[model samples]
Target: MRAPLPLDAVLGLASDLIRAPSQGGIDTPVAVLEVGARALGALGLAPRLLDDENGQPVALMAEIEGGKPGPTWVLNACIDTAPAGDRGAWSLDPFAGVVKDGWLWGRGSADSKIAVASFCHLAAELAKSKDSWHGKLIVLFDADEHTGRFGGIKRFIKERRDIGGVMVGYPENDIVNIGARGFWRAKIEVYGTAQHSGAVSPVPKNATVKLARLIQAIDAVTPPPPPEGAPFPLPPKLTVTGVEGGSGFAMVPNAASLNLDFRLTPAFQAPVAQKLIEGIVAKLDAEIPSERPTKIAALESWGAYKLPADSQLGTALVAGASLAAGRPVPGEVCGPSNIGNYLADLGIPATCGFGVTCKGVHGADERIEIASIPLVWDAYGHALEKLLIG
Candidate 1:
């Protein structure tokens, strides 16, 4: 029999994972998955490597069967981290995986890599235990979650495994996250007749001015916070992230565009938001002459989801997390995550929110609290042991 793995071993594994630059849009996480696979294999568990259509690293799934039979628990962790910006902002190399003063500093150390390493450690330890649960424990680590393309987890679910419940370690500071808000993006284009600054035409209109008007109109429709009976606290909000216009200083540009990003609460529907945007564009078009037409184009849409408080998985996660953290876990609703959407859409009882307090997740000096790693690991281990191990 293999010697029981120590917490230090788990941290070591996590350090190795953080050492790899698995940033989104660059640096494939294949090496990290390979490390996880080797760790799981040491515990007598077989892991299957799942990849996207492009063959980029996505996720890894492993199964550990119990002595008897019980609920099949799914523990998920995203393997990818956002790119580390501005290296000068950090005291150490973002990919160095430096451990100093009981803290681990790295790009993915906090945002997700720690959770991934911790859960892997827990799975390995559980597999070695004599205590028998009635059900199976399923482990999933994905890479595409950062981009929200649903490539990683989507492929994992297509395998048709019976998943009774899911627990996602997504940097929640030990909170029980029931669900999150959704998101939608759009681009508004305003058209006008170009004219020289020196010469004034009979119908002189500036496309940039029209675009600005449309932007203000869309901003006016900002969604309000959730009602008293709503599951989440935030209201729908809109932000114009980008705008572009005139090609030259002296030219009155004929066309201009503004990018709009909206966060939708559960009460807000995508179609409704789309119609609202279209209405704004129509209003702008009406203001302009027939010669100029304003248009609204939707870039992307993702629906909001709220897991029922009484959901089996939600209740179990709350209970397990409370026990693990040695405190009453407060339920929270976060911004939209591909995980929450997948669970709600598939009717799977799932809950996310875990990991440490990461200061710069996608920014420079992205790091996890070194001291929190063991605590998070223990919490995850105990939570899984309670919910899945029965």
Candidate 2:
């Protein structure tokens, strides 16, 4: 149908990005994003860096307007990467951007840098063939994602109210993630009477002991399953992510805390989850009387969401993917919450987790299949054709 995507050009740009260190938390180096911006610039598009509240550059954006008016869509990927762990464990240099054995190797190779490169090339192709489609195509490269703050995306959503839909390139070619499970996070503080270790008469209430009891109580919880016809079948899950407090063994600790994370489902929402956890804490408070009550404070919460079966964005993407695969590529819900969840909260529709086959994401020796690039490129290009032209 359409000419093959600029594979060699995409790989070259992706290699440049992988070699640049743009780890989150640390200020993302501007030079790294400039590599992609320069490519977009060469395509006769104006690319610019977007900044966070504190004036740190956090994203790059380039727009292409079609010959006629239509809904604007965004193609998004993150430029920032998770911290490279234990550099010595890698068989190849983490930042070498090595292309070997039909794979592109390095940090951010799969988790997203390649998508950034591919999207840039795709936008260039669209620019050259403006009559083939309508509506605007914006290439958004988030520079502050891995930090978990999502500052870049937040800014974009706030500023661009005209955005019709977004496609997040999250590195998975087989299944198109149309939605994701939400999450509720909190911290619990358990109080106890601090006392000397030698005092046997009172049998001091050890905070660590109380914390362990709370952990057991929480671990015992079995969240209800999703509704029979729920879009996402994944059930709610609770995890005690961290436990803290207590020092030297000589003295009984007075207080302890543990972090709680609940993966939510449609049937079990954030408020329901909070109530369940609070009920457990209340039961523990009454069952095991302590110096002070156990306190639970919510840290963050996001409700689960699913795109309608007939959603224009989802339908087009699924069709494109199936076309590329020569078989069915089901639109599935992802277990982990992603940028799409945030967009849902804002009343914007988005699709995530569709791209090249990746290996060792967020792990050592991360890479993406070089051959899989065309499939991804074709899938999205075809989706754009459907949405913008028809």
Candidate 3:
């Protein structure tokens, strides 16, 4: 009943959010939430800041009570994004939030500052015309989605136990992301005697060499190939992320750590995956003899989660997507994310991908089509309305 969210306002808010720069774990999300809170409050919704005991705000949640009681819907959009790496790679300032040529280009513009903007206005419109709707809507702006630590969404999950249906505003090209591949955060350390580079050159006993050996061992590990004709875009496996060692040319590295990520599929659960990582470390420790041997530690591990029950909320969302995208959109899609698994583990019907189509999400010159913004926004709102009416 309220006027459809103003187009100009949505664009302006997206630009402001992109400029704010809440880069996941690096920047505090408090500033982003504060801005969101002010906007929500001005629209006559109660924007409450939820924080940990240590006084760190997880995010701002604004609630709207509809005309009648129905299912509660959690509308989530992350305030944080992956750090904008190598600023020079972007043609425009990564934080510029430039809207032109029918596109919004910037670091977070596509990935989700757009959703933040759209969802904000959606909440306001719903609140203004609560009499025209049923059920409750919670607009949530969360943190640490990019870094995947004990972040905003996780903390919020813990704080709010009684949840209904959840819809995540992550980019999926107008398609719903039904399942997300799970992964493990691990570090492999290869230790050796530290000495001058010249002294260690003869025997190659430095940590870097040990690191190479460790990599070779891990590379030798072959997980079973994806089952014939898998639907997943990428198969699950170990991916070496970082090499931490070698201070300078003058010194021989004593300890080099390799940050490894293990992506899991339905075939491999946590227990099986955990043992596989341990076996790699054990094999290297026994094969190579050194007082300071190779060791692998799991910083974190979570198995892939497939929804046990068929989700009616998911059906409603897919239908909504059809309305928004002007075509039937499939709800089943695969992507890399840990949050959906986390939500599923808690027995919540959760899924990501309800935003503008994105390109170069974690790379340079990231962007999204400006037209897709309102499209997904309309779909999300319509879906919520349908679910409550049901």
Q: Pick the candidate with the highest TM-score.
A: 2
Greater lDDT among 2 and 3 belongs to: 2
**Candidate 1 regions with alpha-carbon error over 4 angstroms:** 1-5, 129-131, 194-204, 245-251, 289-292, 336-338
Per-residue error (Å), model 1, residue 158: 1.9
lDDT per residue for candidate 3 within 1-390, as digits (tens), equals 436658888888888888888887788887777777777777677888878667888777887778887667888888778899999888899888898688888888876778888888887876666665667788887766777664677778876767776888888564687677778778888887777777735655677887898888777777777677765544677778898898978787888899988788777666677788787777777776677767768787655755433677788888888887889988764647656777877777776776787788878988888776777878887787687654
TM-score of each: 0.88, 0.95, 0.91
lDDT of 2 by residue, 1-390 (tens): 467887888999999999888888765658778887888898788998888888988889998888888889999999989988899999899999999899999999998999999998888886777766678889999988999888889888778978889999999877999999899999999998887888777777888898999999999988888778767788999999999998887778999999999998777889999999899989888988886899999998888888999899999999999998898999999888989988988888999879999899999999999989989999999998888888
Q: Tell me each candidate's RMSD, in Å, in order.
A: 3.0, 1.8, 2.5
lDDT of 2: 0.89
Please write out the lDDT profile of model 1 over residues 1-390, one tens digit for every residue.
323436577678778888777777777778878887887787577888997777766888888888876778888888878777778888889888887876778888776877777777677777765356767888888877776575788898887458887888887574778887777888878888888866756647888888777777777774766788766787887889999999867777889898888887767867878877877777768777537567677877767776776776777667766765778887788765557666666777677786676677677766666666555666666666666555
> Candidate order by lDDT, highest to lowest?
2, 3, 1
Q: Which prediction has the highest lDDT against the true structure? A: 2
Q: Residue 329 in candidate 2 has what lDDT?
A: 96
- Distance from true location, Cα of 124 in model 2, Å: 0.9
lDDT of model 1, residue 327: 88
